[model samples]
Target chain A: MRQIKLKERPDGMPSAKTFQYENVDVPSRNRDEVLLKTLYLSVDPYMRGRMSTGPSYAAPFKVGEPLNGGIVAQVMESETEELKEGDIVTGALPWQEYIVADPNQLRRPEVHGAPVSSALGVLGMPGLTAYFGMYHIGEPKEGETVVVSAAAGAVGSIAGQLAKKRGARVVGIVGSQSKGDYIVNKLGFDEAVNYKEENVSEALKTKCPDGIDVYFENVGGEISDAVWPLLNTFARVPLCGAIAAYNLSAGESDIGLRVQMPFIKSRVKMQGFIVGDFSEHFREAYEVLSPLVKNGELHFEETIHEGFDKVPDAFLGLFSGENVGKQLVKVVEPEQ
Target chain B: MRQIKLKERPDGMPSAKTFQYENVDVPSRNRDEVLLKTLYLSVDPYMRGRMSTGPSYAAPFKVGEPLNGGIVAQVMESETEELKEGDIVTGALPWQEYIVADPNQLRRPEVHGAPVSSALGVLGMPGLTAYFGMYHIGEPKEGETVVVSAAAGAVGSIAGQLAKKRGARVVGIVGSQSKGDYIVNKLGFDEAVNYKEENVSEALKTKCPDGIDVYFENVGGEISDAVWPLLNTFARVPLCGAIAAYNLSAGESDIGLRVQMPFIKSRVKMQGFIVGDFSEHFREAYEVLSPLVKNGELHFEETIHEGFDKVPDAFLGLFSGENVGKQLVKVVEPEQ
Candidate 1:
């Protein structure tokens, strides 16, 4: 079996050397455990926080331990009555070729007429994050402007489309022209700004003439600064991630927001969250989002890495703004 | 009659030069207007946002116009049936000795044993801000550690005392030793840290050994940098003010929180709010807060400025971190 481990913590930006790939013997399943081969691994921006030894909402990965992620795997062997061979499941598995999971931790795929990889993106955590972040926290009203950063990324693309279906005026902020165009023309955003080219604040001023009412914040940093001035009274900001400032080394200071005072003065609500924190809302989110996906009213994009060996490279690309849509690694062949 | 107008737009921190104290004839009351003799003026931190030309939750004060604030006044003449001569009321009135007001715009105080000045601090907006900002946003659970910045100030003090009343561990962060001692020894905060003297992070680490579950933010900037590292998972931050950053002049470079990305990883909920947004919760807040105050379960202190002429000087002191508790401007003589 092949696994990826945290070799050393990166100072600023992570590189290939930050992760160590190892070949290991696959462990046998105990009494109630099922041995499985990982078919796909989810590569998300949130993993950056796990690399640091700071006080994170989640625990940091110890150096030399195999990096863990949400993985879709097929059961190769079962040691209990509940599971059988060739059954596909999803669970928190490592960045490895195979994993042994308790059946209680395994969730059978819920998607119909869609690739299993959907279980990692729109049908899974990323999709639910967008759903709960917007609906529960954002409470977006009809005809209100909803702004989203990382517009073409896994979570954002879904968030924008969901906002659109709810009759909100959706504006997307992306890093590239292609991503911007995709969100506007293909994904149904009212307008999209390429932050790499145009000034985000200026574009936002033009697009959201009345001001942004809901901000689904996936990328924090300069983009956050731009969005602050445009927030209207009672604006809701659902802070999903801050991929922009993840890798600051010693000597490099953290970029702080000068707009914090304005947040209080403007009565804006900025809430930071993780998908795990909103699990209770999953069933409701699925009830709403599942139909949108089936009716083609909601669409998602994926930047797929070919195999398990490419997981580290895929994750490292997140900080550099390389991947488009939800990033994932195909770890094994699908069963017939 | 006297009125205070904006002489000029402030360059950075507001000074006396920005205000013009002029003697103008008091306008006559219309058929529906009541003549008011100003007795007290409420000066608040949010007024700083109005001083700027930048967009705020409320419209910025126009240059060359009279500065408006919440004021307590006695009805000198009444043209409306609802208000009579000698009746005391409070509402948004300009900074002046006498003025004409529409009776519909005033709310009569239900002042029983409490002083009318309490309406300006502990029983009014600042008090409401602390009440709702804590209950609605912070959502402090029993036994949770609550950390509040600007602990000696109006809203912060009330927030700290409220947290303690709710059975949570409260730690206050202040700028001076005296203010720290007053809060811990007198007002009953479990602990207090003078952010200016000691290493804040170390102090917070020691005081909040279990980690900060709720952070009532009043002073942002460097103080927030230290507090960010000590927050616990599912922590709630009610960001009520960022008084530290209000003095930045034009063309000042951005000072972003470089390490704030952990908010996402830790799943911390940081929300900013203005008091009026939760108007529906005001009665509910008063229902809970009033009994605490009447029973002396909630302790409060006020830093009263001697006269209305001292309003500009009192406001300037706020930027310098000079106040010990709630800051108020006395528009008339205290009861003999």
Candidate 2:
């Protein structure tokens, strides 16, 4: 089986030279283990953070080890009673086409008649991250305007929808004009700012006339500067991810502290959270989100790349805003 | 009577040129008011924010208008039964030798057997600010290492003592060696870092070996850069003031955005708050803090600028780090 491994850490934006594709031996499954055959794997922007050696919520990807990510797989063989042959599961699986995994660590995702890839996108970690970050941290109230950056990405798309359901006027900041239209028309955002073409601050002032009450900060460059000064008093900012600055070298720094005055003046409460921060509430999140996603009350989009070797390219594409929504690599077709 | 007026808006550091001293006739009191003679007028770092025409927690002081701030005054003539002659009160009184104010708008501070000037320092706004910001926002737990910047100042001094009282190890960052010595030797801080002498981040790494669990962010700029990276996962930061950035022109921007990565990687919760945000809880803060001051469990310092005419000088001195603890202009002699 072919697997992707880290060849060298990139200084700035990562390139194809940073990854190595190699054939690996398939490991044998022991007691309480299941041999998983990779089907669909998730490609997220946050994975870029794991490539560097720094203080991160998730451990860094080691130089000679196969890259690990969210993967939906079918159980080829089971040595434990918890999972059996042909059972489907998802978790932090390796990039290889096949591997042995503990049944305890794998999740039995509820597909609910949708594509099995939904197990890695909407009903999985990204969806759950949006649920807790928006509800617990942002706490969007009726008539409040909510602004989210990278609105076309996995977490931001789901977060914008959840904020709308809570009676907030959602405004999204996207990298391209089409993605802006996608979020505003297809995903129900009240307004969308094309960060590429428009004067972001001026656009926010015109769109968010009531002032931004809840800012779901996903991208953290010039987009953040445009959002902060417009925040109303007692505004809440849930710091989800900063795909904009994730690729900057370790020694590089930006002008983020300029917002401290605005933060204090507005009495802002900003928190940076990981999905693992709410680990105990995972089931609670699933119970609420799974139904909305299945019934179409909540909407999601996925951009899929075919074949196993497209994983690294799919991930790198996230930085340039090439993907429309939840970017995933389709490895195999599930059996009927 | 003498009053201080804002002559002009400052570009960087405020100076005597920005303030105009003028003589004004003491105005008559209303039916529900009391004529007040200033005893001790407070000069705080937060006033720096009010001098500029920008978004701030408090309204900006208009050019050619009298400046206003906290003052301990004695009732000279009472037009209401609620206040009588000789009754001492404190509130947001104008920066003048005398004024007329409503009894309801003033605070009849509970002295708890300490000097009446304590009403302007530990028994008043700065004390209450530290109390709520540390307890409610920072949430310093026992055995945790707490760090407070601008340690020898009024708010930071009390905040450090409060953290020590909570059984946490405290590290202080101060401007000079004397202020550094004052906090560690006199105020019981576990360690002190001189931002002027040593490298701040390296100093924090050496002193806060366990990593900072709670950071009372009183000063922004490079000092903030030092404290943020050293924060532990799920750490709390209470944003009090930004004296360092207060002097920077409204148009100037700093490299504050660099902290976002560290903030997210550590799962940090940083909130900016004014003491007035918790107005209903003032009595609760007083009930806990007053006894600590009377019993000498908590110690405080004051830099007294000698006369009512010295008010503007005292206010101006704050940006240069003139005060050791609370900077107060002694407006008049106490009752003999």
Candidate 3:
């Protein structure tokens, strides 16, 4: 078996050297446990927070420990009736090729007709994130303008589509022209602004002539500064992530325009949240999102890298806008 | 009649030059109109927004136009049966000694047994601001920690008291020692941090050892910077005013520590609002607050300027933290 561990905490931007690959023997399973082989692993921008020693929603990943996150695996052998051998399951697991896991810790992904890897993206945490944030916080009304930053990414793509479904005039802000084109053409966003090419503020002003009623904030900093001034009265901002500030060096404050004056003038509501906050209502979310995925009404994209060795690069690529959508690593071929 | 007009838009902070005192003829009343004698007029921090020719919740005060705000007055003459000649009333009106108004624009304050001047402080717009912003937005739970900035000012004072009444541990951040004493000793706050005397961030950490669950944001800038880092998960911030940045010069951005990362990490919800946003529910707020004031359970302070000529000074005193509780200008005695 093979495993990857955190070699050292990065000072700012992480590098390939931050992860250390190790060879280990597969551990035996106990009663009610299953021996599983890793199939796919998810690499998310939020994992950057867990890598740091600072306080966050989730506990920091311990130094010199195997990095763990959402993983899809196939049960090679099962000792319990809950799951059978060759059954596919998904849950949070260690970065190992083959390992022992309790059957209770994982569940069969309800992917419907979508790819099994969709369990790591649209049918999983990212899907639920978009569902809760857009519906519960953003609450885009019909004909209202909704702006989504990092629109081609896992969460934003789904969120923008959801807003469009709600009859909102959805405008996406992306880092590249291709991502912008993809969101507008394939994802059905009303408009797209490439922050890297166009002046986000001016472009947004032109596209969202009535002002933004809902701002789905993902990549913060300059992008957010551009969105603040254009928010309409009673605008709702669902602060999902700040990937732009994830790699700031120690003591470097994430400085930008103040939100007080604009917020007060517009009577805007900005709320920061994570997907787990709405775990109790996840069934409600899946009931809605699963059908959309199955019916091909909800579109999603995945940028998958081959082999477990590519996981670090896949994760680091998130900050540089290298991935069009969900970034994942395929560990091995499933035996099911 | 005497009126004060906006002489010119102030580049930054307004001075005596910003106001023009003029003599004008008293206008005649029409059908459903009343001639009111201004008794007391409010000088609020939010008025600074109106003074600028910029987009705000309320329309900007046009150059050469008389500034208008919440005023307490007595009807000298009436053409409708809705109000009598001696009836006391309060409404948003011009900064004039005597003016003609439609009865539809004014309402008699239900002051219970409190003074008529209380109509402009604890029973008027400021009071409603604290009521909604505290109850609807802050929603501080028992034993939770609530921090209020500009604690001695009108909105902050009332908001802090409201949090205390909710059985939360209340900590107030004030500019002066006297203001701090007023919030802590007089207003029943658990502790007060004098931003001018002590390190605000450090003092808050000491006082709110459990972490801040609700923050009543009255002043922005450094005071807000201190509160963000100390907020607990699911904390709520009711942003009512930002006096600290009201006088910011043109093209000067109101810069501070970025809120994105902190807000996301803590899942904080910050909402900016005015009293009018909750106008439909003003009766509900009054039902709860009027008795608190009449029973003396809700203590209030006033820094009343004696003459109409003192209005500009009274309004400017808000930015300098010279006044405690509500600041009002007494124009004249009621001509009943």
In the range B270-319, model 2's lDDT, one tens digit per residue, is 35443334556544534443343345432233345664334335533432
lDDT of 2 by residue, A247-274 (tens): 6675776456443433433444544333
i-RMS for every candidate (Å) is 34.6, 35.4, 35.3
TM-score of 3: 0.77
Candidate 3 lDDT score at position A175: 72
- Candidate 1 per-residue lDDT, tens place, B1-336, comes to 667787777766676576776888988878889998876665555566677875445578888888887777788889688998888888888877787999888987543335455455555556566666676678888999999987766667777877876789999987778778877876788999987789998999999999888888766667877776566655677666666656557767436432132232233333433223344554453444334334543222334565433433443343232442233343333111
Please write out the lDDT profile of model 1 over residues A23-42, one tens digit for every residue.
88998778789988776665
Report the lDDT tens digits of candidate 3 across residue range A1-336: 677787888777776666777887888878878998776655666677677886565678887888887777888888799988888888988877776898778988766555466566655666566666676677889999999987777677777877887899999988777777777877788999988889988999999999888888776678888877777655777767666677777867657634543343334454544333444654454444334334543223335566433433543343233442234443333221
Candidate 2 residue pairs that clash: A255-B257, A256-B256, A256-B257, A257-B256, A257-B257
Candidate with the larger TM-score of 1 and 2: 2
| Predicted complex 3: DockQ | 0.07
lDDT tens digits by residue: candidate 3, B233-256: 666776666656777778676676
Task: Estimate the overall C-alpha local distance difference test score of candidate 2.
Answer: 0.66
True contacts kept of each: 0.11, 0.13, 0.14
Of 1 and 3, the candidate ranking higher by lDDT: 3
